[model samples]
Target: MLHYSRTCGTFTGMKANGTDVRPWLAALVIGVTGIAFGACDRRGADDEQVAAVEVAASWRSIAEGVRGDRIRRDAEMLADDAMAGREAGTEGFDLAASFVAERFAALGLAPLSDGSYLQEVELFWTRLLPESARITLQAGDTEIDLTIREDFVRSGGFGPGEERVDAEVVFAGHGIAAPEYEHDDFAGIDPAGVILVVLSGAPPHFETDLRAYYSSSTVKQTEAASRGALGLLVVRTPVDQRRRPWDRYLPGVGRTDMEWVDSGGVPFGGYPELAGSAVLSQGAAERLFELAGRDLSELFVHHGAGETGSFPLGVSAVLERSSDQGRTVSANVVGILAGDDPRLRDEYVVYTAHLDHLGTLDDGDDQIHNGFYDNAVGVATLLEVARAMTKLPVPPRRSILFVALTAEEKGLLGSSFFAQNPPVPIERIVANLNIDMPFLGFPIGDVEAFGVEHSTLRSSVEKAAHAAGIVLSPDSMPERVRFVRSDQFSFVQRGIPALNLKPGSISTDDSFDGPAMLADFLDNHYHRSSDAGDQPFSESGAERFARTALLTGLWVASDKDRPSWNEGDFFGEKFATGRVAPVSAP
Candidate 1:
């Protein structure tokens, strides 16, 4: 007979003779004892507490398989200079893909239908020539010439050509058309044959997920194209400028853009109807407003005051740009851990971490933009989590698919492609757990999960966080619109319940400034050469995150019921296939 007790907040096993066992030994003993007792009825809270302790002990034992040293080793190798930043479609990216495939194979994970771990992704690449791009604004007799990459940058998602558009300009407030919200930016104006200049983000009063959807460039451009607009111009307001300064975009002036293609070779996200499009700097936008004798600041104030107004700017812009476009093939490294239970083996719980980053800069002291924290760490965590899963005494009821996706830095293309063209039946895929750039330099006491509010996955996330002895906090920077920024959004777009977990600002060590560390990485090292793997890292933090994610996936896979979206949820109603009334959240 065995008993359990807590000493100094650590569970320990007590023998019938009243002897205390070491924590590790206690966990092993309790795990075996609980398995032997098997299915016991939950008579009361005492049984619940006992069951919880047993789960925590088992999870802790499994988590030990995810070693900090191994994670660091893998991350350093992936972010090595030889990988050339692992940009998709490049040889460097292929090397990184091979590395992940090799790791997956070593763990005894099975490959996809191709009989190999690599799943080829077809992509259409477009690199805009900033030097050749031209933009000129005409206001009566005055013609204002704007410099490329300074005043504006041509937007991607357009086909290759000397594309040009010269037409009258219209100021469309927010450029969103949501009938549910009773909002339409083009209520009074006809978008036909006109260039629509719109604000960058949606209204602040909108719900979080709704705001993210309306604020995205793809949605805005799609709205413009559907309305027969000749072109589109996105301008950020003072609020948006403060959050993400325009100058930050200068470093990526001429970055290559890409979109995944279909079987017929047609690009997935190209909007050919809008012949021209560009993102304007605040200064250029101010100049345009000045030319129209209107205060852009006043318009911003009106927008903040909940006034959605549209008007003709009484000005016109001539936009032209050329791009070097072609087709290339990248691969998403996929490996599956087949479930043991015949009842749920067909259903899968997917784990994704992007394996691509910015390749290299043409003119820079350190050309390699090693994405050490941006995603090398993410892929490392994925590998470690997969390894930990394999160490479980009993496999999850549902199959687990560990996918190292490519081209996430290129606008979530790889995940998007996979969501569209899944390895198994799409409906059988239950949930997505994404890891991207988790804080690895501090003692993490808590974690923030994006996109957990709208689905039943929240319960499992909370349980996992509790089992890992960490707090699950709300998103720290909601203004950043992170819910739609990562690979998880690709799965969310297909109505799959998904969440992206990252270490929160709260730190276990009071002496350390966690927020400052996060801010420094975002401002100084993000997308820069300084993001090298050699930088100091906290292995404990990595281990904690991996454990939390591992437990979350395990809980979801073992549950008898499939995860579902919250009732009347925005994303669920909009994207879920065969849209039905969703089950309410627990």
Candidate 2:
């Protein structure tokens, strides 16, 4: 029996619970299970090192085996041309479901819920058309009238009931409220019902990462609703700057660049630094700003930021007025691998990866963003994990489930639905190990355990990594916002610990080849057609990744106790200090 003890909330369990039982026992299990699995090789390495050469040596072969044979096979099939763009609620998303279902069948994986694998998610499509959008910003006698689409792109204004609505535009400088910063955009102004025209993104007026403030359509939606406005019209500011141009794109959960998302090729999502707010052509934006007696820089710096004020944007629009608003139904694929241990099996370990991306583009490029690297790799590796485990020396003690969510790119819709209305009671879940863009390059060194800051799941990740001789990436990338960016956030919201593991990164301030390689992509292939190609396979990296994950699954699967959050982390506090999970206010 394994002996275990907990110190500072960290659990320690050796093959014999730290006793000399291991000395007399023959090394049979180590040879068969530990050594063959890379368990011995990666025992200890400094934080500064990348490849746990000795550690990697332990599991390289099996990890590579899982990657090359199993993971690659599944990836190829799922990313096949037949799946189309796999847009949420589309025929393609459904087709991909069958493909995944069939793969599960082939792998001999069992159903997770009531012996049935499918979990239907209901989705609604809202299309909007702009009947009227007349906004004129005037300085004295000069009035500038702006039309829609040609001058700006408006997805129908979200408001209660109305055949049509229009409100005068008011320049409500940054619509933000941060008490710590002593800033208040709505301090003295109340532009209710009218269109609240605020500058999109932060300007020089703010300190801190600008991308965190206004990088998505959500902030606009959130603020508009919060301020009790009829609609929100965001004015673009030239103040935005990023390391690269495409950095402006919100690699939002399932979002892709070329209309459709191809998961197989993309790298991890860094916050879009470039200007992501709606870009109104130069001429049109200037005309509107001129009315406020502000030029590009001044308005962006002083008048831009935040989502408050009673300014009406004089904005009216609809969603599907264009040909692109077609609708379809998609699903959330759920599969289960039953645990052999009755008690542990009742406690579930959740696995999730987004399966939707930008469908297709207009330039006659019918190619789907198969999302191979973006998430297909995560999903594929997950499938491979299921395969390896089901063939385990003995079935795991806990249940392992697979979920491929839809519309992650469209604001994490499917996962949100799951989080909101879980098929099983949410509390029964132990932890969620989410997979996303796994193949930027095999982690030559340590894996980036993204939410390592959040939960005890991080400890499981690190221990498994250490057993394999790999170190966890050095620190939390608060700027990277890994917690809020992935579907893991949803699970975290419900009090289940979530772990997001990066394939692994090398040490040296960064990986030796990482920076140059990323610069190359950001400059050239980041979102171009060049990303999709049949390149020579390097088994070393893939094996390292799978083996590490295999160990994590095994560790989490074997233990009777479910993983929890570390006490100090934000998510941990929410659960421990407050028995009830916190949610968006009513």
Candidate 3:
């Protein structure tokens, strides 16, 4: 018979004589006692020990496979001086693509297309000849000459010829014409053959979707051109300068501009009716209002509050620009991991990271903008996720596509091409998980998921973060319009549920200052050459991030039903077709 004392940690068996039995008899008695107690003593301990060992081993394997050392190594290699900053359409970027392809191949992922990992993207590269670019504001007898890249910068995508405009200037408020918002900047005003000066941002109270979509320069330019405007002058406000600093815009003054070429091999046309467009500095913009005897500050206050009105500014502006355009071909590197379930193998979950950076800056002493933190880290994380997914004990239910996109810095052109001209059927693409510039300067306690709330993929993201013992946070800087900034926006435009992950501002413990660290990165290193390989890096944080992304993707791929956009969601209503109603949050 077995006897156990609840107060003690040991179990004992005693014979009928109440004396110690022989060794063989004791062993047999113990075995019989364990069975009699329903194995609560011996079997329970063994089972618990085995289960603990397995769990520990499983996490240990994941940690080891997605280690910081490997991630840092890959980042350093990609951002190395030899890579020349991996500019799109340049040899350096091609080298980076080849490196990603090799890594994908090594991880057992097959080429996305037939025997090739490259998706050729035709591009037109344009650069403005600064000496030939000019914009002069003529008010009465005063003529203020604005220098290129100083007081104003010529906008890209203009046709390859000289364009001159001399017309009356009109203040067109936010320059938006949205009937849905009951707003029209051109209403009751004739902008015909006049240079239209518009604010850079939309009204603050406008709907998020309406604001984001209409605030884009393309939309603004298109609207102005459609209204028969002679030229467009975008006036930068304090808010605009805060969102993107003047110094950041200064670097790309005369740099190469890239855009995707149409399938017909013809370049997309710029606004033909508009003679030219220039982004005027705040100082230069205020001058226009001063010449017109109007307070730009008061105008900003009124427009921001959605009470904007258009009026002629009693001033004329002269603009001229010449461009030296050329053509180049770039490629988006793509790889595929086939799914285990035969029925779901055709459907895919995509992971994207941009592989191109600013390349070599002409003005900086250190010409190479290594982009280590900007995106080399992102691509490295993607590779690590690929490696971890390939090592999963069981394959995912849906296929996984890994894309190292190009020309993201140029304006998400590479991703735009892939989303439109996918190697697989577009319907087969279910979701997109984009990793871009995740600010891994400290041990991240939480992650900020952009666009997660718009789709059912939020459930998978939540589960993944919870499994990793991390919190998931929403976009803290919604004003930045980050959801429309990166490559994920391209996928979203095509009705795919997409999300981008970044280290959050919240810290788990008092030991780290998360928001401050991120602010410092954005302030000091964000598009500059300072974002080089030698910058401070948190490898552990990067590994954690990679794991979080990998788990999120795996969960989505293995889900029985495809992730869907929330019904009536702004993004879904505007972009997706056949959307699903929102489900309860996980």
* Number of clashes found in candidate 2: 51
Minimal lDDT window, size 10, model 1: 1-10
Q: What does candidate 2's lDDT look like per residue over 141-213, in tens digits?
A: 6655655545654432222212344445555665565554565666666655555566655434443223343
Give the per-residue lDDT digits (tens) of candidate 1, residues 498-532.
Answer: 99988887666656677888888887787789889
- Model 3 has an lDDT value of 0.78
Which pairs clash inside model 3?
Answer: none
TM-scores across all candidates? 0.90, 0.72, 0.86
* Candidate 1, RMSD to the unseen true structure: 6.4
lDDT score at residue 331, model 3, on the 0-100 scale: 92
Per-residue error for 15 in candidate 2, Å, reads 13
Model 2 TM: 0.72
